[model samples]
Target: MIISILVLEGPYNHEASDSAYNFIQAALAKGHAIRGIFFYDDGVYNVTRLMDPPQDDRHISRRWSELGATGIDMVVCIAAAKRRGITNEVLAPNIRISGLGQLASMIHESDRIVTFGD
Candidate 1:
């Protein structure tokens, strides 16, 4: 299956991001293809390269960047990101800032769209 993910929440403060990551990992392990991951609202923070957590804590941004490095399309909504003060200079590697049209295209091309958030 070709799956696209929509995340609306941020990391650490909520479980939505973790859940979404686990789901994607599981899907990939099962030989499923991820068409894209669109980060909206607070979810846009997940791809910030400036994120620095405690040494004992999992680096959420790094995790997303590594996943993105696997060739899966990772996008942060440009409008949402800008509203939250996120810019291209702060984006993690392999992640891109794009408009909502990318999300629409993901939905159109994907066989399934799984959303994680309120």
Candidate 2:
């Protein structure tokens, strides 16, 4: 299966980001192909390089970056990102800032679209 993910919530404050990450990992373990991950709304925060957490805590942004390094398209919505003061300079590795057109393309190319949010 070719699946794309849409995340609408931020990290730490909510469980949506963690849930999405776990879902992707499980899907990959099951041999499902992940077409992409589109971060919209507060979800854009998940790819910020400025994120810092306690040493013992999981680093959410780093996790996303590592996942993205596996060749999955990890995109942050440009409009949403700008609204939240996120720019290319602050984006984590393997992640890019793009427009809604990218999300449209992901939706069009994906066989399934799984969304995690309120």
Q: Identify the candidate with maximal lDDT.
A: 2
User: What ranges in model 2 sit over 4 Å off?
Assistant: none
**CA shift of 99, model 1, Å:** 0.4
What tens-digit string does per-residue lDDT give for candidate 1 at 4-96? Answer: 999999989999999999999999999999999999999998989999999999999999999999999999999999999999999999999
Candidate 2 scores a C-alpha RMSD against the true structure in Å of 0.5
Off by over 4 Å in 1: none
Best by TM-score: 2
Where does the lowest 10-residue lDDT sum fall in candidate 1?
A: 42-51
Question: Cα RMSD for candidate 1?
Answer: 0.6
What's the CA error at residue 48 for candidate 1, in Å? 0.8
Q: What is the TM-score of each candidate against the true structure?
A: 0.98, 0.98
Q: Compose the digit string of candidate 2's lDDT tens values, residues 1-113.
A: 99999999999999999999999999999999999999999999999999889999999999999999999999999999999999999999999999999989999999999
